[model samples]
Target: MRVSGLILPWAFLLATALFAVGLYWALWVAPPDFRQGDGARIMFVHVPAAALSIGVYAVMAAASVTALIWRHPVSDLTAKSCAPVGAAFTLIALITGSIWGKPMWGAWWVWDARLTAELILLFFYLGYMALWNAVEDQTTAARAAAILCCVGSVSALLSKYSVNFWNTLHQPASLSVDKAEHVHDAFYLPLLVMMGAFYAYFMAFLLLGVRKEIRARRIRNLRGALAREAGA
Candidate 1:
């Protein structure tokens, strides 16, 4: 718990530093894309959000598994905390991807493998949230929602491989062997910094959400205790 307590403040500091460096690199240093021109700046946010959206789901799913296997309350709360944040990130990815695509691809939307699978991933997050809220019993909610999370992981996997599996407007992997240095040095550095910032942001938010949930639980317990005392 002591180690975990340190994560919040450190995450906040890390996020700030990364975001500052990343913005400088992305906006000032990176040259305009020959093809996309200034519009390609969208990649910094779009790629990181898209990548982290998938990663957050993985975290939720893993926490769900731990909750069920170890019967840990903190694990359940952490899983619950992650779902909404993951959903928000997924939405950001979709929106930014559309914005990035319109001028470049000449279309705002496409039913390609990557897009479709990512859409499905969003729905999965929503469904998990709904399931958790629908149940009145905490234990039952955690167990049932955990199962959904595990099942929905299939789509997450599909999302990762979708570009490879099918011809899509979305470009191939950023780190492909064929295109080791596809992006300019200036852009690459900032993009990496942005990615680090996004990760730190995710951690900070995760811990914040967990703390809020814990406090809510504590308040509920106190309320229950007061009611018992009043009855006595």
Candidate 2:
């Protein structure tokens, strides 16, 4: 916990630095795409948000699994906390994707496979959170919510592969092949920096969420003990 606490400040600072440098580079230093022109700048933020949206769901699902199978209260709290974060990231991805889509696809939205799957993924996040809130008993809610998370993981997978598996206006991943990013030399650095920033941002948020959930659980336990004492 102490290690994670120390990492938090570094993560936030790194994310801020990367974002500052990356955005400046993306906006000014990077040349316009021959095809997409300046509109491609959206990818800098949109791709990170989209990628992390899927990534966050995986975190939620895994934590959900541990919460259910092992009855780990911390896992349950972590899973529940991640829902809002994932939802927020998903919303960012959708809005930016839509902005990019308007000029490129000639429409603000389309029935493309990737787009459709991502939309469903967002719905899943919302549903998971709603389910958690609807239940009053924490144990029951955790179990029920975990089931939903595990089930909805299918949508997350579909979203990740929709671009490769089907015909879509959404372009293939730019960061393929690790060393060789299919983009121009200028765009690659900024894109990579943005990706790093996004990753750091995710880690920082995850730590915060875990810490918050842990504290909340502690408070609840204390209150429960107090109630028992008062009754005695």
Off by over 4 Å in 2: 178-181
Report RMSD (Å) for each prediction in the order shown: 1.9, 1.6
Positional deviation of residue 159's Cα in model 1 after best superposition, in angstroms = 0.8
TM-scores, each model vs. reference: 0.92, 0.93
Model 1 lDDT on a 0 to 1 scale: 0.88
Tens-digit per-residue lDDT, 1-232, candidate 1:
4666788899999999999989888888788988889998999998889988899999998999999899888999999999988999899999999999899889999998898899999999999999988998777988999999999999988988888788887897664335464566667667778989999998998899999888888897898899999999
Residue-level lDDT for 64 in candidate 2: 92
Cα lDDT of candidate 2 equals 0.88
Q: Which ten residues in a row have the lowest lDDT in candidate 2?
A: 176-185
**Per model, how many backbone clashes are there?**
0, 0
